[model samples]
Target: MLIKGYDDGPLVAGEPLMTRPGFWSNHLMGMCDDGAGHPVPEWFGDDGADADALSEVLFDPGHWPVFRVPAAEGPGVVVVYRNQPGDYGIDYLLTPPGRSSTEQLTDWEGDLAENGLTWHELVRIADTPVHEAEGAADPAARLLLVLPLLNDLDLPAAAPARLGAALAAAGSPQDTVTHTAESLLAHLMGRSRHDADWASPLSGGY
Candidate 1:
């Protein structure tokens, strides 16, 4: 269910119209003129113009676009926004149960504690080693580090082992890591049940 901006209103709860095993979360943000001369908020100061534009396009209701992604476990909010000068941005905000009325770091911290580690420890384990690389690092390599850490901490695994294998085969260790992190997040934040409802998309297919 979707709740629009700046209002305190009741949410009509029901099963989602469609249920997939996993999906992407997209959020939109950016700076634009809005016909005014002043610049909108700068996400990266000067390097965020494209991001801003993307946000505007995604959030413009006239287009009435609904993002479709793989299904996830817990409840989440999809955020889309437009900035000054007509820029846009998009991303998914996972809203786990009992975390908070508003999505915030405190909610994240609470989940971290619910697992075996403090927030600091979680962050430390998730941190990537500093290195200069030509392109983005492979996600699977990062997953190798993350999955083990989450396992060691007794955190619930979000993505199954199959997803990891897919990342490994695709040559993106970081994607594997990202998939693992998402799974961990889903598990900690209470989305695992939802994940279980769908046939494992990454199952043997991965």
Candidate 2:
């Protein structure tokens, strides 16, 4: 299940399609600060970890890199960006070809049901403008959001190379942080297989 959106605002209403320029432009300049010039978070480091991660996506991009937490429905990656200035909000993306069905793609409540899970979760709900331009007639289609709290999710031990360290250095974990990629993946897959909607409230995970 792939979940993607921008921090400045919700994704374009309709197809959820975003152009490469729209995606990469803000990333190239690093995070915006409106005009306050806020310091980068300690986890991001002086070298700008967020920008560096975006670079990785641009160059050796694959299925997108799934970080820690919430496990994964299949195989994919999570991409983040700071689209707006002075906004504490962060954009998160769960790439595709992973989950068994699209229904789970945007489900947030379903992710919290994992046993022993910590980290906070917030879903941004962007309403469709009065004059609709991007999305469909359905009210659900106009809502644009991302799980910014994922930054605190735990990382798997053998996760790819320095991915664990990167996540830690970025300060994404909120608790003891000891879940593995394999287990997370299995959990997501399992939830998808069963009737886990009982765990979530929203009709669509979006």
Could you give candidate 1's per-residue lDDT for residues 45-67 as a string of tens digits?
A: 21245444544544454442332
- Report lDDT (CA) for all predictions: 0.28, 0.28
Best model per TM-score: 2
lDDT of 2 by residue, 107-195 (tens): 22213323211111211222222232222222222111122212223334343222223333323243312222122233333342323
Candidate 1 has a TM-score of 0.23
Ten consecutive residues with minimal summed lDDT in candidate 2? Answer: 115-124
Q: Cα deviation of 47 in candidate 1 (Å)?
A: 8.1
* Candidate 2: count of backbone clashes, pairs at least 3 residues apart or interchain: 12
